[model samples]
Target: MEAIVPGPDGEGLVETRLRGWVDPASALAAFRFARHAPSAELAPYLDHHWVVTYADLAEPYEQRIVSHPTVNITITDDFRRVAGVIKGGFSYTMRGSGRVLGTRFRPGGFHAFFRAPVHRLTGRFVEIEEMYGGAGAALVAGVLDEGDMGAAIGVVEAFLLSLEPEPDPLAEETAALVSLAEEDVTVTRVDQLAERAGRSVRSLQRLFRDYVGVGPKWVIRRFRLHEAAERIYQGRDLAGLAAELGYTDQAHLTNDFTAVMGMPPSAYARLGLGN
Candidate 1:
C-alpha cells in the first residue's frame, strides 16, 4: 500500500496518513489510516488508527459503528461504502483522541485496541463491531481535498465523555502493557513483564485477557513482527534489524517475516520503494 502524509496546509488539522487500496482494480478494497492525536497526548499514546476495513453491498444499508472506549453517548458515523458487488469502493477510517485507550464497534466488524500484548496472540484481524460511527465518514469525506478531521475527532471525544465512569483497573494495566510493547517489541514473556509491573504472572495474564482481549505472549510476538515489517519497509539492515529486535538469527527473522507478512523481508524493501 502507498501512503502520503498530509502537509501543514492540509484540510485536517493533524498529521494524516492514507494507505491506497492494494488491489486498485478489484471489486474488493482495503484501506489503512491513522491520525496523530492532539499535541497533548502525543508522547505515550502514539496515534489513533483504523485499519483493515472491507465492504460489499447489493442494496441500501446503513450500520452504526459504536465507540470502542464507550458507546453510551458517542456520536460518530458508520464506516460506509456505497457500491455494487462488482463495483469497488474504499473502506476508510478516522481516529482521534489519544487519551482514550479503547473503543467499541458495532457487531459484525473488527474491534481493535491500542493494547499490543493482546494483539500478539489474536493477530490484527478481529470481529467486534458490525458497523462504524459517523465520525469515520467525516474523516474520509474530502480526504483528498484535505478536509477537517479534527472536528470529527472532537465529535468522538464528546461521546466518550458522556459514558459512566466505571473504573477498569485491568483495562488500565493492559493499556500500560500495550504502551510498553509498542515501545519495545522484543520484550516478550509474561513473567518478565509481570516482574516489571510488580504483579504476578498469573495476574498479568488474567488482566491482559480481560482488557486486552488476547494473551500477553501474543502481544509481544505480534508487535515484534510489526516492527520487523516496518524495518523492512524502511530499508533497514536485515541483520541489524534481527539483532536489534532480539531475533535468535537472521533465519528466524526471515521465517517470521514470511509467516506473518506473507513475503520475505527483501520483497517488502523492494515494494517499499514503490516498485
Candidate 2:
C-alpha cells in the first residue's frame, strides 16, 4: 500500500508516495498509520484525519519525520497542540500501546479556523487550550474518551463544523499556489512562483508569510528536499539530484540535506536500504 500523490497541474513527477518520512518501511513497521477523509463540510479546511496506533511493543520506536508545510492539530495522551510548519525535521517516540489522532490542515486552510496570521504558529507548538481555550481542552478530552477511531474523527469534524467557517477564495488560491510549489519541480525559485502567481516577489512573500506560514523560498526548498529524499532513497545520483533541485553544486545539496535530514543523501540511501 502506497500513498500516491499527483504531480503539478496533474502532471510531472509522481513517484513520491511517502512524502517525507525518513524511512517509510521502518515507520510502517513501527506502527499502524491510517488516513480517513473528513466530512464534506470540513473538506475545504482539512486534508485528512490521520490516526497512528500501536500496541504491546517490546521496545520504544523512534520515527523521524520531514514534516510538511502545513499546520497540524494533534491530540494524544502526552499533548494536544496546534503545531505549526516545522522548519526542520522532528522525531516522536512510541512505547507500549497508545493512539495519536491528528488533523492535517491544508496549506492555507487553517486561517479559517484560527482567524489569524498563520505565520505566528510556524516552528511553534501551542497548547490547544492556549488558542482555543476551554473549548479546546474539552475537544481533547472528548476525542480521547471516544473509543471508535472513526467516531473520534467525527468528534473533531463536528467541532470544526460548529465553527461555521466560510470558504475563503484566498485560502484556496494559496493552497493551489502551494501545490504548484510542491509538485512543479521547475518552480525552484521564489521569483518564479511570484511570476506564475502574477504578484511581485515582495507581495508573494507577504502572501506566503500570512497564509502558508513561511516564505515562498522556504516552502519551495522544503518540497524539493522532500523530492530529493524520495529520489535518493530510490538510488538516484547525488550530483544529478543537486543540479535538478537548483543547488549551486552537489556539495550545496549535501549540506542542505544533511542539515535538515541529519545525514547526507548517500547515508540516507544506505539507511533506507538497511531498513
> lDDT for every model?
0.42, 0.85
Query: Tens digits of per-residue lDDT for model 2 on 1-275?
Result: 15443321234323325677887878877777766667888888888877778889899999898988899999999889999999989988999999899999999999999889999999999999898888888899999999887788888988888778999998998999999999999889999999999999999899889988999999999999999988788776666778788888888988999999989888889977776
* Tens-digit lDDT string for candidate 1 (3-107): 443322244433332222222212122222334443333212223423222233333322112112111112223422311111111232433311112222211
lDDT for predicted candidate 1 compared with the true structure: 0.42
Model 2 misses residue 235 by how many Å? 1.6
lDDT of 1 at 252: 91
Model 1 CA deviation exceeding 4 Å by range: 1-4, 7-151
| Native-structure RMSD, model 2 | 5.1
Off by over 4 Å in 2: 1-16
